[model samples]
Target: MIEVTDHDGVAILSLNHGPVNALDLEILTELPTALARVADARAVVLTGEGRCFSAGVDLKRVIDGGAGYVQEFLPALSTAAFAWFTHPKPTVAAVNGHALAGGCVLGAAADVTLMSGGTIGLTELGAGVPFPTVPLEIMRYACAAVSSLVLTAKTIGLAEAVSIGLVDQAVIPEELMSTALKHARKLAAVPADVYALSKKQLQQPAVQRIETLREQDDPGVTEIWGSPATRDFLAEFMRSLGRK
Candidate 1:
């Protein structure tokens, strides 16, 4: 799931489930807890092991586990995403590789997102799923081209991602962590109370929308994700990718 290490006063949280680090229930459940454990740190940096920030949800698991899984996973997804988005300390995403669908949302949720050699975008629609309320709202708050990215379900290169505000900076792969730490440390230098207050103020509207609409919206999103048609589509989509 997640590996936590302390670098000076900054807590660096690495996604340790290798082979693309696809989001699953356990990973999602552990994420917020990991953030909570490191709450006293001045800042946090999130990155993935290997060449992926994440490839997004594990559709194979979804299709295999069926609706029962979707019911549990959806809430965990929202919880983890909301926690990442609202973390009081300075948060930085060191996106080292592909960040698609949920992965993109996780990166964007951070106060500062920096990437190296990855493509990033919202591709959930391509998988025949609608965005859940929290993820949709976070993208709306963080990305300048949320509508285009979500609708098209298309991933763009680092340069375009930076230009469009999907990420704040594009660093070389070798320098990704260092650059992320630099940004994190700079933000960490701000007075904690002041920084937390400003972040909360800036994010209040999106946070409000998430709180107000999630109970209303997630059920329908979960229903679609659990539908037979969606399951069939996901099965075919996985086959097309040469996955099981």
Candidate 2:
């Protein structure tokens, strides 16, 4: 679910789930430990090993008691991402492909995001599920970087990602990793403690909002997961995907 490699104070974290790299219980469960292991690195690059960066949380998981499976889930995943967001070191996202939902949020949370021309941010609004509040907060901060592209979702192109500020650099698919690593190395030179603290201060307001939402609304997860509207949305989404 997660793979980590380190080189000269730099770390690469790859999401390696099969196919679309959708966030699932295993990935969510294991991610925090992975983040912890390389938390001391001067820089980190997050990428995925597949055609899609991540298709977001598995809809099937949600329909089939995902609420139970992930009852302890979002907080863990959010905590890990928050670590990345405020890490003293710089972080880069080498978006290899489509970064929908959770995947998009993860990329945006990075200090700098680089995308292959094919990368896109899809919120899954069509699915009828409420957007995760944590990601929305992340997106709020990312607006300067990738708002227009995120807004268009499917219409996003590599140039669009850069123009909207979602990605610091956009490159050909084959060059994505090299570009990300190069950028990460440059960022590694920043004064770590200062950079980290600065990032924390810059992000405190958004983080606080996320915390409040989680605290107040998380208890409703079970009810929302079982609601008639949720069921109808999932069914329609499944049907659209031919999963029905």
Candidate 3:
């Protein structure tokens, strides 16, 4: 689930769902509501508990849930991504560990990302899963180098992630939260109405583009998630994991 804690005026939303914090329908559906609750907070920090920020979606869940779940899931997922990008208050992602696929997208979607001690990248290509509009736009809006993630599926280390601007700050594990809080407090100091208006103005184009692309791209990708070809690929990937 989601844990909301207040730090001064900043709200930290920590996802703690089993090991690796694999994102599931539960978190996807709850995230927007969480953001709504923190609307008055000066700023927000999103992170995950345990060893990894998230290993991405719960793959087994996806393989088992089939098309019906994808239909219900993508909308909620996209909405959460949009919320991260356009939250009236500034947001930061304190990446505690490996963030891949959807997890990486979550970090990239934030206003500032502070990652600590692990690899983070989009590995969607190898999984035969496609990116939805909002995640793609978040990456594009955040950094230009992320354009290559769609074409490759490799995990990048802390230096590489920072060099590519996927992460704004890199720190030792102990320093992660303090560093994130420092930035959060800095942004939170901005007057609420002024911060909201400027953040909206800055994000409007990207948000609008995400909405535009959602109408055209989300359906096709959801169809692919349920398509026979993708299912076969997922099955083979599952078998490979079993062998490991």
Q: Which candidate is the best by TM-score?
A: 1
Kindly list the per-residue Cα lDDT of model 3 for residues 1-244, writing each as its tens digit: 9899999889999999998998888898899999999888889999999999988877777788888887888787788888778888889999999998889999988888999888988888888998889888888888788768777878899999999888998889999999999999988788888988998888888888876778989889999987767778888887986899
Error of 3 at 227 (Å): 1.5
Structural similarity to truth (TM-score) of each candidate: 0.98, 0.88, 0.96
Task: Report residue 190 deviation for candidate 2 (angstroms).
Answer: 1.2
Quote the lDDT for 210 in model 2. Answer: 83
lDDT for each residue of candidate 2 in 1-244, tens digit (9 for 90 to 100): 8889986678998999989888876787677677778878889888999787777777787677645654655565566666666666788998888887777788888988888855566555556655456666787887664444445445466787687777778778879888888888898777888787888898889888988887676556546655667867887888987963
Candidate ordering by TM-score (highest first): 1, 3, 2
Q: What are the per-residue Cα lDDT tens digits for candidate 1 across 116-222?
A: 98788898998899999999999999987999999999989999998898889989888999999999999999999999999999999999998899989989999
Q: Would you give me the overall lDDT of model 3?
A: 0.87
lDDT of all predictions: 0.94, 0.75, 0.87
Q: Give the per-residue Cα lDDT of candidate 1 at 211.
A: 87
Error of 1 at 203 (Å): 0.5
**C-alpha RMSD in Å of predicted model 1 compared with the true structure:** 1.2
The 10-residue segment of model 2 with minimum total lDDT is 146-155
Better of 1 and 2 by lDDT: 1
